[model samples]
Target: MADVATKHPMEDEVKKTEASSLVGKLETDVEIKASADKFHHMFAGKPHHVSKASPGNIQGCDLHEGDWGTVGSIVFWNYVHDGEAKVAKERIEAVEPDKNLITFRVIEGDLMKEYKSFLLTIQVTPKPGGPGSIVHWHLEYEKISEEVAHPETLLQFCVEVSKEIDEHLLAEEEEVKTPETPSLVGKLETDVEIKASAEKFHHMFAGKPHHVSKASPGNIQGCDLHEGDWGQVGSIVFWNYVHDGEAKVAKERIEAVEPDKNLITFRVIDGDLMKEYKSFLLTIQVTPKLGGPGSIVHWHLEYEKISEEVAHPETLLQFCVEVSKEIDEHLLAEE
Candidate 1:
């Protein structure tokens, strides 16, 4: 729990707490009723502080300050919903690992005027013997007026989101024979085979196929330079595609490069690849095979995902695989 002191009480009490109680009038109030369930293995332990990849009220999101995953991080959001792209900024107020409670305060945004102000805090608590964890969507508010819109509708949407997460987690847990190691320590090692180069060592990596029909966003997406100097550190690029009428974009930055070794690291900086996915990083190692050895390439990608978008990684992996196959076929035919 964060030691945040409310600037003032939920609302100003006309007289006093004792006086309000005596008069049977509540000093502070909330028009929301919320509940939760047991632990869902896939999402319960993962970090929660994130911005919707498509930030606006619309179909896409981006954070304000751009620090999407770290504590005390601030991000702005833009979304188009019902034809309106409303924007908002939020800050992570409190984080409790043992208790699984992560809170973000809406410092400024569309929700400010409705209530004197609002604090949005979410908690993933144990439900004892239940199959899924209880996600507590607690919104503390100081309303500007009695006629202000209640947060009930938003709470209702959160409920649906929790259910969706539960389903996705359950399905994923069923597919994996063993649970993934939750800690970052031992989980980094993967079974991806890296065949050693014989003489002039080469690497093998997977890249996505260009979506032929859709024109990618030239600014920050799609097989092109997105930001900064094209090949320098801090430079940015966007990879994009459209699947089933939904557009997908991944934001990445050039973190490091070793020209001598033909190596580059692309860090996911921002974009609309997944809901609540702030940053994803990929490391590509390229080397010449020598003696007509053909080059080898490898890709490593990491991202933060919302419980709802937990399954996003598999899709990206598939894209990598498909692209790899095509590259191999093309190279063989050329020879």
Candidate 2:
């Protein structure tokens, strides 16, 4: 070459820093007068509904990979970013309902073009002895190059969206609360794809209760037939499960069974869960995936907590997800 290129010292240092695995982080916190559980649920389970609450900032959120409320789901967002229409594709990386924390990783879109990686985590915690909650937003990113600008505008946009969502939730709370109606019940739904036959999965939980421990022994310590034949309505089933690092037992009665629909419902009548919940019902529905050989297991929980002070059933739902995966893996191995 006729001419040799020269790099400045500062530019070389910046390149060195960018080459290393160092990530820049920013955090923002705000306090709002909305129910902490409601706020957490909106972000954790129903983010698609956020467009209705913050239409000015978020146009819509569409699920691309998995079902809502399930980890590993990919969501595409049509949003306004710095006075321009933009899209961001993110994956649900981690969800800790017990702590009201949800983390999302940006895998594509405008942010990815400027950064090597981007992660956004939102957490809500009840204020001590107060009527509101504290929401924390944290952003972790690695720039593709030193020339990329800091994400100050992105942080401001998040703050504005949070404020809008808080106001929207408060308005809904006022409209729903009345003398005739009191807040009492809460429900959670989760879906997992299993590469197994739908009929086999349904029969395992329905007619063959004793085989659960064999399939997922770590999660389900054991199961015993307490009363009528296995999988029949009015029959009783007792389960020993490891939940929240504790070994506990639960007594439930078979409420309904539909072979045509591949569904089974169990109503908790006694044991550890009853201590905190007035009633707990679990429904498992397996449906054959359209144009596929596998199945989708839909797990639904309807429960009434003893009081509003108690936490939502996030841990319980997580437990369900673990068990579902364990069973799914066991089935796949058999094939």
Top candidate when judged by TM-score against the true structure: 2
Residues 1-335, candidate 1: write the lDDT tens digits: 32222122434422223422222111222211122322222122222211221122223222333233446765444444334555556776775656655666776767675655566666565445543344555666666765765555555544555554555445544555456533221112111212233111212212222321121232213466655555678876666655434667766777886767656677766666535555566665553432233444445566655544345465555555444444454445434
Model 2 C-alpha lDDT per residue in residues 1-335, reported as the tens digit of each score? 00111222322222223546445766667678887788988888888669879999998675557877678987778899888999888989999889888889998888988899999888887888879887877778888876887686897798788888999999887757756324557788777778888888898889887888888898898888999998999999999999889999999999999999899999999999998889899999887754447777778899888887777788989998888888888778888
Lowest summed lDDT across 10 adjacent residues in model 1 is found at: 185-194
Error of 2 at 62 (Å): 14
TM of each candidate vs. truth:
0.40, 0.51
Model 2, total clashes: 0
Q: Which candidate is the best by lDDT?
A: 2
lDDT by candidate, in order shown: 0.46, 0.81
TM-score of 1: 0.40
lDDT of 1 at 113: 56
Distance (Å) between predicted and true CA of 159, model 1?
1.0
